[model samples]
Target: MTDGVEPGTVRPGGRTARVREAVLRAAEDALTEQGFTGLDLADVARRAQVGKTTVYRRWGTVTGLVADLLQDMAEQSAPRTETGSLLGDLTANARLVQRTLTDPRQGALFKALIAAATGDVKTAAALHRFYDIRVREWAPCVRQAVERGEVPEGTDPHDVIRAVSAPLYYHLLISGGRLDEPTADRAAEAAAMAARAGVFVRVGGKQA
Candidate 1:
């Protein structure tokens, strides 16, 4: 085990990689079908056709396994899109989030993850890390928009990227509102407009 690293977090290769893939997939299946409360090392081992001892040794606990699962998800998430325009790029991003949140399996999986995060500090941290990775992935697009003079010089790129998907997530987790294409477009439009208006501009090292 690497020093200071959590169990099941070290990158592996060959057969180890295969095992990790199987285990993570099984974890996702458990989360989607039964939520975090139902996730079990032995059950996941059985689902992956691996030895329970191996699962227990590698993941240690369900929380550790879920943390690794979220890390894996962050690494596997789709790369950002570039449409040569801020609004277009934001629209693409919003639509991508909308699609993921609306897909039956993915939607349920996210709901489970979010529910798990609510009362679990480690799970909540893992969830935050996951979104932080995703936001960093798409932050460059907002920077590009700044280069094109589409937004203010001090506008926060990460904030703009998060804005595009915030409403979609709200719809998924909160109001249970519509998540159609039009809704996604509206989200992108609103974010783009806000960015243009400098609503996300940093003032004195903080958002104005």
Candidate 2:
């Protein structure tokens, strides 16, 4: 967001990186406690103990700040687990999602972000990018499954990975159902079944 110091140009653990960490943590706390509409750069600056001018110059706008927050979330997401089987790996993935969406702070932050994305195209793009990064993080699990002959070789890894978490999100954002670990396992089991049966493979007879 700053001029001259391009995005991703800051050295790791540098001053700019430290400022981003503080600001983003403050932003996360605000979003968790008061949702997206309550997000303000001044408040974030006060909370982060950084200068208002610095926050202003770094992020420019609330929308830009939210976008940066999403980018940080994408980078901070955990890598995929390596279980011995497809179902094991997917279940682990599903449970990670379940734990996140059920946790009070994490759930509230995501809800605020998702709600903001509904009306803002830029926010929606940022949200999509966040999901893409998260999905890519776990895509390797599907590739391993293919090598182990658990799923079809031509399976679309991203499709299978998304399917595992789709229902859990439905419960969180749409269905208002439970977010229990069992529900997570069921979602994972169903996705793994579909994937093994080639239901998640490309429709065009192509591999992804």
Candidate 3:
């Protein structure tokens, strides 16, 4: 989904754009400090120094605002790294996720969003879309690996990309373990090895 307001409601570098930027940053601050359950449109408007009516007109509900926030984040996410080899590329991807989840603010923000998604359908769908975009961005690296004959034919690029970050999320949200460089490296290495072993290969339109 598109970020912020609907089409033609905001123009680039216009007042509406500025308002969107302020509101989204405020939303981030709220999510970081208070979690999803604490998010309030009036509070966001106060934080953003914008009119409550404006926020309401643009985003409608707390869930709608959050959906837009996720879209904005996806759009602002960094481009995938190209490291010439699948292991190197996957390592870069893993390290990126590690750093984000290890950061004080980002980690809390993601944890809040994830917790929100567990019970909220809109939040869950937004979160899924956010990851889908990110996965697509990195999937090309795996496809390139296939082209280079580094992985078996029919290797699923999306699966390989997801594998690199799965353990990192598990550490962040489940195990509460340290997300150090070694952990990221191990995740990347395992995914690379598994890909080479045909563990991610597709058979009959399904993962084998």
> Candidate 3 — what's its lDDT?
0.92
Q: After TM-score superposition, what is the CA distance of residue 136 in candidate 1 from its true location, in Å?
A: 0.3
Model 2 residue runs over 4 Å out of place are 1-13, 203-208
| Of candidates 3 and 2, the better by lDDT | 3
Q: Which stretches of candidate 1 lie over 4 Å from their true place?
A: none
Give model 2's TM-score versus the native structure: 0.91
Per-residue lDDT of candidate 1, residues 72-169 (tens digit): 99999899999999999999999999999999999999999999999999999999999999999999999999999999999999999888888898
Candidate lDDT values, in order: 0.93, 0.88, 0.92
Model 3 regions lying over 4 Å from their true place: 1-13
TM-score of 3: 0.94
What TM-score, over all chains together, does every model reach? 0.98, 0.91, 0.94
C-alpha lDDT of residue 14 in model 1: 81
Of candidates 3 and 1, the better by lDDT? 1
lDDT of 2 by residue, 100-127 (tens): 9999989999999999999888789889
Clashes by residue pair, model 3? none
